[model samples]
Target chain A: MSGPAYTPTDEELAHLQKLSSEFEPEVTGPLVGERQSSSAITTEYANADPVYRVKTAALPSKYSHYRTCRGDGHCGWRAIAFTYFEALLRLGDRNRFLEEETRLRSMGNLLNSIGFQEHLYEDFADECFDLLRKTESLVSAGNDERAAAELLASFNDVGVSMAIITYFKLLTSAWIQTHPNDFAPFLDLGQDIRQYCSTQIEPSVCEIDHVGMSALAEVLVKQAGFALEVLYLDRSAGEEINTYRFDPVSNDGLPLHNPPTLRLLYRPGHYDILYKMEDVQQPAIPQAPLHVALADYADEFVPMPTSRGMSDVMSLIPGMYPTGLGQNWPSVSYDYNPSPIPQPQMAAVPTYTSVPVPTTSQEYVNTAHHNVPLESPVGMSLNPPMTIERGGPFRPSMYELEPGFQSNHSQSLPFQTSIFRNSHYNTAHFLNPDFQPEEWSPDSEYVTGSRSRHKSASQ
Target chain B: MSSSRSQTPTKRLLNELQTYQSDPNDALVELGPVSDNELTHWTAVMKGVPGTAYEGGRWKLDIRIPSNYPNAPPEVKFVTRICHPNVNFKTGEICLDLLKTSWSPAYTITTTLTSIQQLLTSAEPDSPLNVDIAQLFRLGDFVGAEALIRYYTESERWEGRQSV
Candidate 1:
């Protein structure tokens, strides 16, 4: 036996391993987490661990909030599955929920073709369907907050959560089987695609890899149209987390325009959801437009007359002259970000610079205020703030003549000047104004193709 | 979480029971829980194929599924002892890959039992649990192995009747 095996008596290493093993969590409960406020994540991890400190510190800039998921092996599937339901609930569209329910039930065909009987996955699929049905009733009753809360509750329940997770695993496994040729070249781990899926991907506690994530994304994104981005926070030599986008294309090969409805913070071993604080805040703040000028550079670069232009001009006039006229423009930055109607890319204007607006305590108000109409239609209430609240549409405004109002939040450059200078926008345009977004529609061309190509190349 | 955890296995077991009861495979197999209140422990009684060496044999398996039933595979063993190269004669432990690492949640109690039945017809001699029987079969001693298997089946059947 080549004498005795070589062994090292590393005392410090043994001590560290013992200490870490003590923290290795037991998988006793269901594979889900109670939805925590995004800020709570910062409070929970910002100080205790340096790695998490780096992750949490960088998280709040791009993602102003994050919900910590349970660190079970099923975190990847559970996080995405919970987000799928929550996204539907946030849309508050029952018909869409029903359509999703139908589509999920139909995935039984994928399972069946792979030789699983109906009863095996029927119970799990039924649990998901039942959750959808219950959520729909709650949403339709105008209890969106309750609907969201209850949905999270159900996720924590073991039976329902595992069922959904299992069904997800099965469908992903089936996808690998049904399209073996598509997956074959990439199964380079000295195992066939089926063995890899069964051994490494389908089990309840198996953490997913790039192929697993993409396979699940192929099934879900195509069926549900929910775009996903996973910011991988690893030991890589970067201040920012590496982002991976998973957006499956339609049959026509045209990429769906669904904005990344779900964002996940992926540490080496686990995944959790990230929230944009701007999207979650309620419109309740003293009208200071405190950082309006820095953000207003977006106004000077306005290129066209759109509804977004009118809203920006309307929102700006008050911020432009908060104390000049007797107009009380209660901090309208909430209106600055959450435009109910989809608008043109005013946020991406090349000349504009992005400045991080530090969030105030009052911004913690729940996202329920998202439904409040942007502006009163009749404009009878001449309160500048109230007028912006009722400003439903741009209604062919003569105000288009105003130059500073051309850009909207969509045009807001994704690169915000972080309080931490280390937090540079990884994109080339952070320093260059001549960056032609037209060469690549930064918003439309999702990172999916590039990521899949990378995965294929690695294979 | 514990209640829900138990509920999934129970619910799956009940669903399988109902499916088996409704569409009974009368000629081939009979399966049900050991007691009405117990879903995790089941009894599967299967008949030998008509023309195989195991013809006229009756076998009963003790199927004890874990609380994580479908996710984790069931523990199956022969309550009615029989001789086969791939099975331990004393413990009735199987040497089938499906009952081991190859298990998937898609495999139900019915599918598992059926695979065991197939294993009987076509035993994998190379990976044998009963090395003596495997050696006999390897040495073109089919008659010796068949006689022993038939005798073991009959003795097991009579022992079952006597217990009843």
Candidate 2:
């Protein structure tokens, strides 16, 4: 017999409380899954509600790829953390990694300012920084694929990934505490910021909420000049997924034109990483070698035409042969001046020198002298008009010369023209596989006359 | 793989042990690994808060740390019977949220014990592990609760000492 008649009810309540506290939803999958085509999401929702089906079906066209974060309660935090590193890796810039590390390390002061014990938080912080340095080394070694694999592996390791999530949670907490005015209005009325963080942000099991996401984006993503975009896939009367974007702004308060972005797909409680088609492009390294090979092939096969008819026609152009007519035109061809006035001439010289001689009465008879085969019909049909537009005197041969010629010319004129400098084909371009940001050199600016000439050509 | 899995918690536990040794908390009487080879199993002796009914009594705690140590909160329960609303009298289970869902990697064993010490002074009667004790506090029977807490604190004080 129980001592009190009400004891049975109390026992039942206590048992239920214990059960609720210990209950964990069944979560199965890699902690952070491999990136896969987002069309898989459409397949997943195909049999579900029509709203989700429609939204998921439209997903891949916009967000081409996705990475799953296991549906454990920490999915939101893990998704953001995984995508932040991924966005950095997509940049393929070694110095960006170093800059991020320095920026994160400096936030230790923010952790300290919020009364977070340095020794206690440092373990989590160190795990994060160590991953950054590891990623930096991988990126510097030009092993992007391996670096990406290592990043995914680290995040999938429950211990390492959870440590990073915890560290981010702490940063978000500190950020909220430091900037209460921005976040306090979002909290329950009269609720203390510290109490809210302890209950909702710092807890390892707590899923990230809207306020926490904002704070995290502010401290982590936006400050690093990276944008955060979340696409909400909910049944809220819309055919399309609702998107919320937090864009990074420059110090002058203008939004950055196209900052590196970390994107997430939110399905109610769970979050997964989402990527656009451009986000998954391989670094430009492999294409460079192919271009070089094409250049070599063009150099071996193209006949240098010496047709007097072509020279006579070329002499008629105003800016052609700027050193005057009949003044060793071959020597003039070698001038390599990228000035706007001689660009037409330079374009003509490369066409005649590198392109197979087109079939003309004068050159057709002389074609046998070069010992190269005649142009194919396809090459003949495409070449003549392009050569004329490029201001060459000869009808363009079917064999296009630019691919090989540009690669060859690039070596001699490292920064060809403003257009070339701005193009993605330049090694200095961020999209290039070998992305190295152009650094200003005082010696090159002052010592080289050619550098100034190239600068003026850009204008 | 197993060794690497255990490495982080092991290293973290050692750092915590060193930190405690260098600057031990006033509320903690003793805290460390139960044996030299087993870093995961720890034992801590915590003094009750100075102004609480359980004052002058020392409570022994058994702490089982998971291999994923700071990422996962260490399991802590009292070894000595204590009279508190938020602590079980029959079994030594505690009802503090800090030891459960509110746990953060920033918490150390010493800090957790300090929180337990604080918990002794400020019991949450609404969510009680010891229903009778909670009923007394809810009914505002302060004198009766204090008498019961003091009686257990004195009687069960030496129950687990020899084992430690």
Candidate 3:
């Protein structure tokens, strides 16, 4: 290498240096883009190297959806922060939002212990807290679509988004500082943790490195009982993207079962959110009302002559009606024995059926018409139909008589018998459209034993 | 969206002004908006750090805040000329990372001014805006650097006082 033929003078050199120093790569896009199909990623990589094509081709199958974060140096932090609130929204739990607010607020002590100025950091922290409250209200109101839209809108606001990112960055710094033993080994020889944090973690223009990501996962994601997963989509000679998961654990140190996970797709220097098919599943909450209403209608109106004929016709269609039809129908008909049943069960059924279907013709006209008002009393009458139906020739189990019995039974009954666990009738079985995994509970183990014995004796 | 874009910075600036008013830092001679109607453009007066070569000098700073203040850092520069490694003598532009990439929403006007005052006592010669002054400091010629700094500070101090 030799000097250029026309060597620049000092003044020219200074101007060139200033230009180079001021050079910023032109960045364009929303701060956080709308959720889009991950298949677009596959298409983007289709013309690239074979490795990228292979990896991205496999991406959509596992991670069905992805949202892009603007690659202006804060993508990783913004991705994690956006996903954290999004994971909370996915939970759709009101108290979880409050609990998270309190948990983050209490971390002020952590922030304070590390000498972070409270009054200064509080402005950023307030933005995060305000977002949580806003999302909490939306989730509480059962407006998840609006909640999600509002979340995307909030993050798109540069000031609000940067505030949250700054707050999270400070938290990550504080966490790393407090847990030096966990992170110090990753630093250069004898490098001060505080120096590394100020340089690499706290700077607004510094993208999150691996160490910062781990600290953020520990401080924010894991503490909230949500897992954090990073999928490396690089040319690492693999057909599938490599995945690294940080699972939240119970107090006993076991990874929590099926915890809601926050996932990020890391392609060298940038990060975007990834979603498993299960993650974007319309929360079972909205659908549960429709299911309950149909189940209730079937229970109440099945005893009526016309509706029984309709169900008989429905049963003729293979797989349209659930199995055990003969057993359930006989029991339901038995319950219709004009025996002057329990006043509570009679009142519950009539109240639901009467209010929703004002005219007799409307009741029999079409099932779809009842969907609107049927959703209102889902919270109230979910268990009553099962209770009334169980008040037949078969002895009602103590569990069935309890409030919230249907949900508990639906979740746990698959485990009561191996035959049921393997059968399509178990909602926990994968063949079911609304497949829910059978969650094992220590309290339910005893109930399972008693119910199994009672059921075996009845058989 | 536009209203909210301005509202957050204005609110934060007001809160910062109140905090600065209630508990002012000793190093800052005065800090506030240039005009009551405009919060984004302001002025600051800082006393040079004690026991430094630039001591006994009053430095006026031009502070131009972005619409998204706190999120985006305020631009602070010297209005009264002084000689230093990290400050441009003619342009008054500073080379501190705090006003650039390292800026955070946590920093307020008072805290930033305090940092600027601190920057006088701890000049980084390695990444300097004024190559001539930085060369003096880099060559371990502190006496020469101090003389040049004092000459500029004292001469500029008189000019600054007259202008005020």
Candidate 4:
């Protein structure tokens, strides 16, 4: 967006490319496009991920237990690496780092509690130490009086990779350790946040697997936070990753039986989540409705992209996709299934006022039964009225309501069928006056929303 | 652990697991073990509900029950190539809440099976497990709809045919 588009020089691109995970294609060829003075950028690894500040509830959330979700039974495993890359960006936001550290500690605690043995994670932890120390050194030097900063910058690429790799190792190792019996079954399971594997495995085994996953998720959040820190240093962090999403990681890159397959990144303040499916090379940026731009900004950082591919991009440009959403670096908290409530099947579908209704004239059971409801020069208006639908080129505006027929319309959000649940009778507001029963019934008030209100009020 | 124990899922099913079985008396549907030795695993045949496109169709499922019995619910996945909103694209990972966190202890294997049958009968393409089906339904492609119906109703599905 700054001036004419500028392509990085070959040497610079190569240098940046080295930071990427093996899977992310390196931009090393000649610069096809002319370049201009782009914004001064952070070293690729420094801005590899955006730093998130923790935003937790004052009290613990009932569903507060976050998991990395190693599906040992069905063998669907996801590894979360909380990487703190403190090399380039001297993060002025102290609160962000602290929140992340707290999260890391919590993650460590989560792993420990779930009967996971730490021995399995030693490989990952060992590799991460050197990277973190290097990151610290780079941050200490900065644009300093000496060549120390440059030296640290040189080491950042290898160092960040080590940190990320080791962190993944520990995450997967610990997850597997917790799920020993189920571990072998998950050897094929791709590791990453947001991958669902369907294995008709046993319940006890699944519960144990979930606990291990929770532990892994904790670490991943922290690893993501490190990338976020880099983003905080320079807005250029936004430049590296294009809005087009791709897969998260490769199996070899992040260890323990699988790669990070799923990546869900929220635009800052939880506005939208970009779900990156593994194997999908590039995904277009989800265009938000114009109204999305008008929504007030909350001090929230949504989930960042945590797939292997996104992190690979972060390796090159830093503060791009996955890097922007650092784990443990909290912002506004959100729900995993940020999915809107399911539209319940009540007696009446929520009838919105403005959703064009087919005038009674055009109502027909089938396409052949279509009878245009054109008024035959009926009552004259006080003022000369503008022509409504003079059978112009437009086909019939679909507003027909066939009994039991679902309207063929696209909604901005998912509607919840649970709204039709009579089960929520415990609450007075949700309960119907006539059926004040204690039991949760499927036939309840149409989940209270504006559309439902419109349908009831019109009656 | 006893020799007298009916380890045969079909045998135990007809006796001890009677309440948990789908409607076995109806010729349209069948319930028994997919394997001889595995008592926890069962197979089911669901006749496509009438009035829908799949009226004559049949769907097959491989159900694996947990040892915890009634304390937790069993796992049910479609083995046949039936098209529906709640099932996954590549694998049949159903998106029903009852199978996941929304599961209640009171829900029996029979109830869950019935729930799945209902899902098959009334396919809600809006809240879809497979994005493809959702897209097709959204585009109003009823031809794709009938094709899905043919796949389910075919006799091969009843014999536990697997399709890629």
* Best candidate, TM-score: 3
Off by over 4 Å in 3: A1-13, A285-459, B2-7, B158-164
> What C-alpha lDDT, on a 0 to 100 scale, does residue A356 get in candidate 4?
20
**TM-score of every candidate:** 0.61, 0.69, 0.69, 0.25
Which residue pairs show backbone clashes in model 3?
A: none
- Write out fnat for all predictions, comma-separated: 0.27, 0.47, 0.40, 0.00
Q: DockQ of candidate 4?
A: 0.01
RMSD of 1: 17.6
lDDT of residue A185 for candidate 1: 76
DockQ for every model comes to 0.31, 0.32, 0.31, 0.01
Every candidate's CA RMSD: 17.6, 20.3, 17.9, 32.5
* lDDT of residue A341 for candidate 4: 23
For candidate 1 chain A, the 10 contiguous residues with the lowest summed lDDT are A287-296
Which pairs clash in the backbone of model 2? Answer: A284-A433, A379-A398, A384-A396
Off by over 4 Å in 1: A1-25, A28-30, A37-56, A189-207, A248-252, A258-260, A278-459, B1-14, B21-28, B35-39, B47-58, B66-68, B82-90, B93-103, B118-164
**What's the candidate order when arranged by decreasing TM-score?**
3, 2, 1, 4
lDDT of 4 by residue, B11-122 (tens): 3244435543423433237676667677788877777677776676666777887654333457888776666767874576776756764443334455577777777666
C-alpha lDDT of all candidate models, in order: 0.64, 0.72, 0.73, 0.37
